[model samples]
Target: MSEHGVDSNQIRELGRQALGDAHLQEAYRSSTLRLYTHRLAAVSEVPGFERLRERARELKREVMDHLDFYLAQFAENVERRGGIVHWAESAEEARSIVGEIARRAGASEVVKAKTMVSEEIELNPALEKAGIRPFETDLGEFILQLSGERPAHIVAPAIHMTRHDVSDLFVHNLHSQPTEVPEQLTAIARRALREKFASAGMGLSGANFAVAETGTVVVIENEGNIRFCTTAPRVHVALIGIEKLIPRLADLAVFLRLLGRSGTGQKLTVYTSLLTGPRRPGEDGPEEMHVVLIDNGRIATLADEKMREALYCIRCGACLNTCPVYRKIGGHAYGWVYSGPIGALVTPQLTGIQNARELPFASSLCGACRDVCPVKINIPDLLLHLRSEAQERAPAPTPSGAALGERTTIRLWAWAMKRPWAYSLGSRLARWGQRLLARGGWIRKIPMYPASGWTDGRDLPALARKTFRERWTEIEKQ
Candidate 1:
């Protein structure tokens, strides 16, 4: 596997290990289920919740349509606010831009707030390679950093960690006595991180939204760490994807309203900071502030009429909790910086169709995510789009005959679906087979090439004894 590519099989095994680890699974399950329930309650609080989603959808659509104008406007505003704006066309460019800024600023140790774009570009590894220590200030990130693991969830990075696992880690890494309680474990982490926070020379963050009119970058967080990172450091740098820019300051009202409700079911995030520029002459803040606007495949995405909607995602991770496939396989199985329904669409486009060919087919197409999205990204529609994108290029040559047979079966199904009569005939044949296969009022087994394979693990619900068309035939005879 390539260094950049995710090993899904390995991830699957890891997820299983993590799941069976008992201590971590309960912590993860409890935390995730709580957040999921809260989000539902928060959205329910609003009388016109669905209406707000519709408006937010329109706003995102409008901003994305005139993205060029907003990006230019945002850059200009950054300059006016005593901040330099750097445009990074690729991951390497983003790294080099930040690296250059760090070198010139004489920053040896940098503290990072939660930023997924940085992960996409492998920023921590790059910074380490440059002899600069990049510390993860977010508690979730800090844990994953210690464990040398990738984030398991979008909003909650270390969602996979159990309280007991945390206790073990604190016992090992921070030299604290082992305790399974959440409070003690958190206290240990807090004490250890405070020293790093105080000594950090620079702070790096990712923007949730950039107001083009004000050139203000907004960051929303539950933890106090991001606040400390931005305020304590001599230099502050923000990394944001180009799609993050929204047109007006007023437009923030709609996004902020929906963001928290969708993310954790909180009426509002604990902290919502909107910083337009660096410290003024009288202000006590970072002396130097820079914002890196990263394009990395965003331009290619912008050109895509159908898939551009994927760019509107706010990274709430609601889709992950709701997605049946993601719930089973977890983030690692998607094989990229992203996972879940949104990842199913965005990953293939961000990398290449060839790179994420298997991901589009991973979804159950239940449309649960589409119903929950604050910005109303039509997730199921996008999944279908990705599936088409996947099929455009044939899977590479497989030495294994199993893979070849599977490919042939898929090809045959695709061809048959194109012909209405062939599809109807296949459906009729399937119905006929179900008549015998079904026993005790349900299909317990079906002995056919694919049906047998499917029924091996799952009980097949038998077809209705008579089709609607057949029932209609009896009515006509009567």
Candidate 2:
């Protein structure tokens, strides 16, 4: 959001300050764990899980290969349905288009259905500049918009706020009372949003998937707020990334299966609606319907053969829920609209090779993300590829004293690695050094800089008294 890639460093500095505040951490952990656990349970219920994943992967591959054809067909279909389709080549154009729509319509208030693409384009700021209020109708998004913060989780935006925080925000900002209870908080929000929904002139939402054959946009959500946004406003606008287009109405079943099971672990979201066009003739719908299909660096990503699968993501947040680093540090640490393993690979790729170069290296390369991605996006492989691309494109960082020290250490290790006995000896000696420095089977402190962060939440594993080579010989005697 800040500068693009590691565009998150400024964000990280801010989020670290927030994470230190106990209330934020408590709120983040509780909500994330609950969503993560629920998703796992739901995925387990579906038989032939791997087979479902395979189908999704194949379908996505097919769509990615024929992206241009599908985009043309989809645009034609939307036009046929009497809906205007706008093509935005950049984030700036996309923002201007939406703003112009709202301005031309003479709309003062806009209700939103939790769109990440809008966030990516900073649409709220643009709408506000036009003297119009943009309201996030989804519950989590509403909480975040109220908190004056960005979403920490992809699917769960207010995952960083605890019950008490929400209560405080409602009472302090909305000029109301205080209570930590869920039902009461929900009631307060519902009452407030209900008033806004009825009066808003325009509703904006992100399409979960756009059907190529029918020119239909599908939105999946737990709250009825999305439905509210679609019907309550006189004008409706949906912002979608180009890759969200899938070929047919039938393909929806494949993604729908994988989407909920992998993201939130439900059989289906609370509401899955297909919106074709503005109230069709006599139907009760918005007076005008417009779909702005955004390219916004997607075409650049499409050009790369290796990274194209990154576009197939449905924003399920499953990979985030399962990431070891994400689970501990959380999404804010990634410092962007999209986070977790998917963010690490795709953000740098989309933003540029030079800007967010550090992100691809942030992963431990755990395959959890690829395993859990219902669409089977091979995240680890993509991360490695991005790492190579980032290195090839960027001017290597000017090494500080600590980085020089690390380079020297690596050079020494390389020298040893060239000789088998020396390499073995160095590894053996290193394990001894670790044991000597450790206290109670964990490194209590490291006399270093970045390594200190690793020790923050975990203990170093205890070394085996004997090396694997030693143990192997002993086992061989049997």
Candidate 3:
């Protein structure tokens, strides 16, 4: 079992449960369809969208190639601007560093913007263990915080919840009146988080992009709460993954354009704050600024040549919105903080293939994710790579009767495929055998072995009455 006690090996069972729930199906279908549609409309407006994607991919490749140089330069610039940079090689170290920073600041409570890295490290529990309360200020995050559920989507964390769900949760937790109006719900959350923003001694966030040229941390959001989380408190902290670094400030423009359009279908987000360092003279921001550069398995991922392309992901959630498998199973079913095609690659690599062996096999290889990706990560290719690795690392199969039967079946099939006479005879046998199972030109159910598994969820087309070889022979006669 992993740290979260959710086994990625149980993905098949979890996926089955997700498939059975009508409400979850509706929530995922509607939310992903909306985002996917918005992205299409947004991309159509930009004639140079493909060029932008290529440029972004090249920039990311350059940064990954010379990551050591950029990290040093970024750290030097950050310290030059009076910002403290802390390095953490593991999740435990990262959490300890954040807890110590809060303690040094004498903070009893901290306000946090929605940062997936923080969730990745399980920072909230660490803070609470050290006798500090951490408040989530993002509307979706706040709703999940009160309801005690993990985020269901990357951009829209509360995408699984309906307006009625939010209204009911607010009534029970916030002691507010029940109303299905979206504006009323937003007002209620805003009113509640304002107190946390005012009283909290420290604010925390995750950097969307860290400019190595000037040591600037760039954060974008549709809600204004992140601005408060970074500026209103006496001390500010940003937890950044090591892969979040970009080489130059000029490179930011291409990514900013891609991220917004790919994420929410907006040309640009509402608030894009660029914080260089601590508050300057007469500035209205935190007195102290800290940026924690966290590795936590990323360095290991960077070491692999073929797998390094996974690092190019910008977390726009476009892949999730466009993935056929993710549209059905949702985020929680992935059994980790990250979800969808990107998650399938990252989770196994970060958590170990033994822990998440089933994740790589969860995709349909439909190429929608790769098509929609802003950075153009070849998700299908990477998935196949991981699948091969998982099989290699998997334990030796037990020689049970069923297992032996499967192996024998595969060998026989291979032999028949290599011989024309055997292949033709086998097809004739299959056609006659399938007659018992076929109904209305489709095989709705199969009573044996691997064929039963296919029929459980979907129907298979029945074999044609005449073979293609026979049709070709008739044409030759003519």
Candidate 4:
């Protein structure tokens, strides 16, 4: 179990459940395909999109290389701008830091913009435990909060849900008249959350990017809620992962361009807020601004050269939209906050491979994620690397007498493959053996250990009637 109490080992079972639900499958298929298509269309409009990706990759690499210097500079600049910077080495520390800050401010409630890092650290539950209520201001997040469900996608938290699902949830929780219209649902959530925003003592958010040179925290969103979350309350706190920093303010534009296009097919998100610090004497913003820089295993990822590229992820979730495995299983199956291809890489590393050994193997390794990644992260390569690390660290399986038959079968197959005569004989025999099970040019079931597993989910094409060598020989004679 991870610190979050999520077991990555249960991924297969969770994936199975996800696959069996037709509604869930349709939801994932539609949402991901739409996002994938949008991203392609958006990227095509940019003549140097690949160059942009390469540039983004280079900038992230620079940050990862000199992370310490940039972090210190960012902290100094933030402090200079009157924003307090809190360092948290782990999830518990981060939660504690934020909780303490809330307590000091005498905040009984906090209005939060959509921030994955807060979810990563399980801050909501901690806040509840600390006798504070945290309201999720994002529409999708708000729906999920009402339902007591975890996010199913990084970008679209309630991607697994439908309009009907949201309507039903709103009717049940908000006591609003059920309506499937998108605008109606938005109004229902907004009406409920507006009160929370007005009454909450503090505003909480996660930084999309924090500029080292200018001491700025950048947040982008389509809705205007983030603006309210940062401005409406007396106190505002931003939870940022250590990897969210960029070297300079000038570089923010490059990422903003990539993030919007890659995430939602927009030229730019509707509201891009640059927060430097708390409000000045007559300003209409929070009186106090705090930024919690949480490591929570990012430093460990940084130390490993092979896995460092995972940090370059801007959380745009383009990889998730393009990943086949993620499209099928969805985000929750990976059993952690960050899900999809990037989640598979980040989860095992952040939570330890022993706890999340199955995540590295949960991919088809199709390289779709690699192709769509805004920062040009070679996700397939990194997944393979994590698979190796998981295997290396995995305990050796115990010898079992129940496996004797399988071992003998493998040995015989290996022996037969080494000799032409034996190989030919084996294929001929297999053709004869499959005659009983073969139907409609495919073998639907083999009724055996290994082959049965394959046949359970797939059909095997029946072997050809004539051998290739025999056909070639006949052709030569003709």
Candidate 5:
């Protein structure tokens, strides 16, 4: 339904557009490579990284299995410690809850650290509609806000933009002198955001992990803005997906070790803040703390047998960096907040199978993402499962007539594949038919319907004159 040609239905089109943009391709390639290399080095330095990954995986499984109990326990602890917890069953409910909170606080502006949940609910627009301006305090998020763009990558957010692109944006929007140096650009962002941090009435953030036993919301960041957001404002709001819950405080050690290394290759992120509740007497924290537990399709995802492992994702984005498809065509092509291999598997369930049918098929099934996953999520298997679900759920009829043509074609192919003589005959016919289109070992064009899209960007390799089965029989006779 996206008129912008970036929706799930237009995955091929979005990819083609991204591939044509030289700057975007270069930016994506370099940034992904750098992050990928750093992650490798950092994980290598840690002793028994594989064992640590297995422990993290086990912890995730434990949380998912008893999510309701842990959630109730977490809510009780939070409320007991002078903090409030809000449960949101839907994205609209989440935005309404946050908007009401912001309105009650008489907030004019709020400083927000990078919270993907907030993005999930489109919270900034809700705040704006309620006359509260939400400022993105994280550097990458701030850049995106200034440029009026959504996050292209989950971890980096602005990875698709080059230094020169940022330089132009700052110069045009901030009225700052253009500078292409990364350090100077960062400094400029730091200076601009410091004012927002000091003046904002409330701070908003997302939790990386929320411990059930202790009611602690753990945030890891290198920018120091998350700390500032939590401490500087009179009121603090933390939005977290229900899946972020872990059973015990002690479990933090394994996750903390893996998150930083897997995400950005840091042994530990520069700042790891654990906020329990509102500021105590004579404490330098917010006077009020609010935690919004969002379940917009997450509970549905948890129930899905094929997709439950997706909840184990820590959002480290190691999968994105290692994904060949993501490398070729950055995250915007996915047309959602989350992207990459995890996105393909999780987005369909998070959004809907019908809405995101193309996502599962976008991958090359290279299994690189599964290899790098800290929690060992089998993404390729999940994708294939979703593909079957999508196929099963697809409507059998179009507005004009039956949608049975493609299905019939597939059935005919399957029938032929089961019969040796029919399969051989089909192969021989295909080879002869392809001769007209074949040029220099590739099929430059396919006059056939549906197959026409195959040659839009990449060529299809021509079929051989002899089938492999026939060649094998000939060799045996010889």
Candidate 6:
């Protein structure tokens, strides 16, 4: 297997592992179902849901098309409001910029909100390398942090872990008594994170939208921990993607309506704070505010006219909840910061397609993602585009021995398909030859053929006596 390509064997192994774990299966299935049910109810109550989605799409398109102008304008306004803006073309640059900020602040500890971009750049490890301990404020993120695990879902990061699992983790890690109660678990996390919020020298977060009109960055969260991270710390750093821009503050209202409803079934998130810059005069907020605009492969993404719709994603994870494939194997199988439908579409692009070739093929192309996306991104179309790109960029090598023989047999079958007489003769030969392998009307195995691997798990259907074309011709004559 190519180093860039995801190993097919690894995918199968992870899938089989997930399927065998009854607890993990239940955790993913129930959580995703709940979110799906909530989203349906919330979206149904809105009168113009589709129109709202289109409006959101339009706003994003406008911002994306004029990205440079808005980005500059947004930076100028932020500077005017006593904040600093940094531009990072790559993940290394972003990390260095953030590390400098933390080091300058003499920070020993940093508090962070739930930010996918931070995950994308692997920020926590960098901060640790800089001798600054970073604490995850979001409940799900905190759980993953404690357990040393990656996020299994986009919105609900620890959706794969059950309450019992969490309880055991806490008991083992935090030295707390085992308790499966959700509220107690939340309290345990809140208590542990509260000290980090107060003692940390800086806070780091990701913005949902960066409005060019007022140079305001908007963050929406239900936990209220984000509120503390943005305000409690002396220095606050917001890492934003170049694509997360809007022309005006007024446009934010349209997205606010869709984000919460589509994500967790609320009219709006519990805490929606707009921070223009650092604290002013007597107002209580961070003393220093910095916005780092990251363009880690987003410029290339924007260049692709066919896949640009992916830039409109708002990180809602609604598509994940609605996807059947995501519900089964779960997010860990995708082997990246993101998972599910959005992951399948964007990961190969964000990471090199060569490194993530299997990501595109991970999808079933069911179109549920397109149905639930608030911005109405054509996820299926993008998946197909990436699948084709994967095949073109990284074709599978021909195997030697029995596998090579199977390849030769398939090629011969294709040749026979082009000629009518050969195809008829081939069908008759297959019927007679398959009888040798068939047992109880099924092919148990085929020695020296790659078909055995497939038949190892499930029986192959027995071949028919006559081809469909032959039967159809006879019926026509009658």
- Model 6 has an lDDT value of 0.89
Pairs of residues at least 3 apart in sequence or in different chains that clash in candidate 3: none
Candidate 4, residues 1-478: lDDT per residue as tens digits? 5545867767988999999999999999999999889988988999899999999999999999999999999999999999999999999999999999999999999999999999889999999999999999999999999998778888999999989999999899889998999999999898898888889999999999999998899999999899999999999999999999999999997899899999988889999999999998877899999999999999999999999999999999999998889899988898988899988989888888887888988888899889989999999999899887876796324223334464466678899889989999988999999899999889998776667667888999999988898699889988
Better of 1 and 3 by TM-score: 3
Better candidate by TM-score, 1 or 5: 5
In candidate 4, how many Å is residue 131 off? 0.4
Candidate 2 residue 465 C-alpha distance from true site, Å: 12
* Candidate 4, poorest ten consecutive residues by summed lDDT: 395-404
What Cα-based lDDT does every candidate model obtain? 0.82, 0.83, 0.91, 0.90, 0.89, 0.89
* Worst 10-residue lDDT window, candidate 6: 1-10
How far out, in Å, is residue 115 in model 1? Answer: 0.8
Q: What lDDT tens digits, residue by residue, belong to model 2 across residues 115-197?
A: 98998888898889989999988888988888877788888887777787789899988877899888888888898899888
Quick one: how many clashes does candidate 3 have?
A: 0
Q: What's model 5's TM-score? A: 0.94
Model 3, range 1-478, lDDT digits (tens) per residue?
4655546777878898999999889989998999999999999999999999999999999989999999999999999999999999998999999999999999999999999899888899899999999999999999989988777778888888889889999999999999999999999999998889999999999999999999999999998999999999999999999999999999999999999999999999999999999999987999999999999889988998989999998999999999999899888888887888999999888888887878998988999999989999999999999988887795324323233454467679899999999999999999999899898899998766577777878999999989899699889899
Q: Write the per-residue lDDT of candidate 1 for residues 202-232, one digit (tens) a residue.
A: 8899999999999999999988788878878
Top candidate when judged by TM-score against the true structure: 5
Which regions of candidate 5 deviate over 4 angstroms? 1-6, 395-404, 432-444, 449-462, 471-474
- Show where candidate 4 strays beyond 4 Å: 1-3, 395-442, 462-478
- Candidate 6 lDDT by residue in tens digits, 431-461: 9999889988888777644676668678898
Q: Which ranges in model 2 have alpha carbons more than 4 Å from their true place? A: 1-6, 10-21, 395-412, 420-478
Superior by TM-score: candidate 3 or candidate 5: 5
Q: Give lDDT for model 3.
A: 0.91
